[model samples]
Target: MSQHQILSTEPKPFVKWAGGKRQLIQTIDRHIPVQFGTYFEPFLGGGAVLLHLLGKNPEMKCRVSDLNSDLVLSYVTIRDRVEELITSLQTHAKNYHKNPDSYYYGVRESEPKSQIEKVSRLLFLNRTCFNGLYRVNSKGKFNVPLGRYSNPNIVNEENLLSVSRVLQSKKIQIICRDFAAVLSDAKKGDFVYFDPPYQPVSKTASFTSYTNKDFTYEDLANLVDVSEKLSDKDCKVLHSNSNSKEVRDLFSKEWKIVEVAANRSINSDSTKRTGQKELLIKNY
Candidate 1:
């Protein structure tokens, strides 16, 4: 499809990522720099902000990365092998419908070897899994149980197509790497958005296991250092994190911190999902 056609379809995040910015896009939109050079997103979660920016400027150059190799592969597969990935998803959907209970667990336990199958399995599990979460155990195994959905949209072909086309742009480069690596490439005038796994507000609220490795306090410290360097280089840096004392303490007074209301939809307790506040820190 043409680039204009792809942009018109409004390509969105293909997976339901934890800490996804879809809900906070309106507030985030207000904070984005009006003009910038290359875009950098080291902690690309659901990529809501990336897609939002791309939709507004399809030609925008973006460099996005994540530590999760499987998630990164999904983006590449959708961009290069979307048709095959869709076909594989159709098969998964067929079998999942036949016996959700058995098939869901079976796929969860069974890891596929092929790239397309791997991406398909991840998408299938994300769609039918509890709260659409992408959590992994200490051993890097997906452990989220099946969610109760009478009818889940397993095969969102149109959105996938849109996502695929938008990703096909040569200006967009997806990589699997540590978040701090952005320091190597980010330059002055670039816009860098950091949506890292948030510092938990409480002991029970911690859910940073997007991979087998939990995002530690040490990682948060590294993020602070990186943000500081990026700020020194004059790069437009915007960050999101839970409104916690630890997070607030790390960022200095120079960074503009805005407290925005957010919903914690991934929380098991529905009552606690609302009335959450998140910090949006930016250096203009």
Candidate 2:
């Protein structure tokens, strides 16, 4: 297929993730630089921003990474072995429909060693888990309970195909690595976006267990330091974090910090889900 035809579908994120930027795309887009070199996203959760940017700039070189190995593997599988992955998901969907509770827990408990099965398991759990939230226990296990969706779209074949096409580009590179690794490859004029798990505003709001290790205050501090170093290298940096005084204090006065209104859909209390603010830290 022609490049234009491939990019026309505009694939959305296949998995629902905590702190996904899908709802905040409009606000995030406003802060993006007019032009840049390779695009780097170290915290590619749901990849709402990366996919959105790719849809607009089809040929833009992108280097995205995530600490979650399974999540990173899913991107590679969808890009390379999409048909096989789809078939696996179809089987999962069929079995899940037979008995949602039993199948979900069974799949969650079984640690499939193969790549295809591992990614398939991750996708199945994410789709069926409570609120589509990806959380792990201290022992690094998928612990979220089954969600209450009457009918969930487990096999998103179309979106997966579109994602595969977009990701097949030679310019797009996905890897599993730490966020700080970008400092070695990112040069001047490149755009680096950091959407790390937001620091909790209160004790009750802490939910940064994307992996076994929670994104602690020290990680946030290190992230701030990394952003500062990226700025020194002349790269354009944009960051997303909760609107908290601690976050504001960590980022120095040199960074342009703007508070944008955002909704918190992960909150169990529907009343607490709306009217929240997030900070958009940038260095032009």
Candidate 3:
């Protein structure tokens, strides 16, 4: 298919990410370098921005990574073995539609042996689980209870197909590594976008439980140092984090910081979810 055709039917994020940039796409797009070298996204959560870039320039060179190995495996499976995945998801959707309650928790407890089964289980849990929030217990097992949706979209074939196509056609590198480690190959002229787990908005407002591990203040400091080094090497850097005094203090005056309103997906109270401020920092 032509790039224009794909662009017309652009593939969006398949998962409901906690810190997803779907709502902030236009705002972040405005800051992307008009023309640049390879693209690097160390914290590739949900990959909303990466999809936007692929839509704009199908041949764009990109390297995307995440700390979540299961998430990375899902991305690779979708890209390389989407047909098999679709078949697997179809079975999940049918069974889920038949018995939402029993099937949901059963699969949650049951472990799958194959890669396809594992990816399918994760995707199914993501779609049907509470708020689509990916959280793990201290034992590193998914523990979110099943959501109360009457009809969850367990088989999102369209978005999955489009995402698979984009991954197959584009010059993209998908890896399972630490953010800083995957960033080692970054060179001058490359544009690195960081969208790590946001700095906590309040004492108990952290959403970093995507993995068993948490992104502490020390990691944030390390990320800031990495971003600065990348900037010094002449790489265009753009990052997104919670709008907080500590986050603001992490970056120097050389980087431009812009505040934008984003809705918090995890909030139960609808009124409390809106108008939450997030910071977008860039070194142009």
lDDT of 3 by residue, 69-107 (tens): 988999999999998998999999998888998999999
lDDT of the structure predicted as candidate 3: 0.88
Clash counts for all predictions: 0, 0, 0
Query: What value does the lDDT take at residue 206 in candidate 2?
Result: 92
The per-model lDDT (C-alpha) reads 0.92, 0.92, 0.88
Query: Model 2: per-residue lDDT, tens digit, 1-284?
Result: 45566456888898889899999999999999999999999999899999999888779999999999889999999999999999999999999999999999999899999999999999999999999988888898889899999999999887898999888899999999999999999999999999999999998999787888788899999999999999999999999999988899998889999999998798989999999999999998
- For model 1, residues 75-106, the per-residue Cα lDDT tens digits are 99999999999999999999989999999999
- Indicate which candidate wins on lDDT: 2
Off by over 4 Å in 2: 1-7
Compared to the true structure, candidate 1 yields what TM-score? 0.97
Runs with alpha carbons beyond 4 Å of true place in candidate 3: 1-8
Task: Return the clash pairs for model 3, or none.
Answer: none
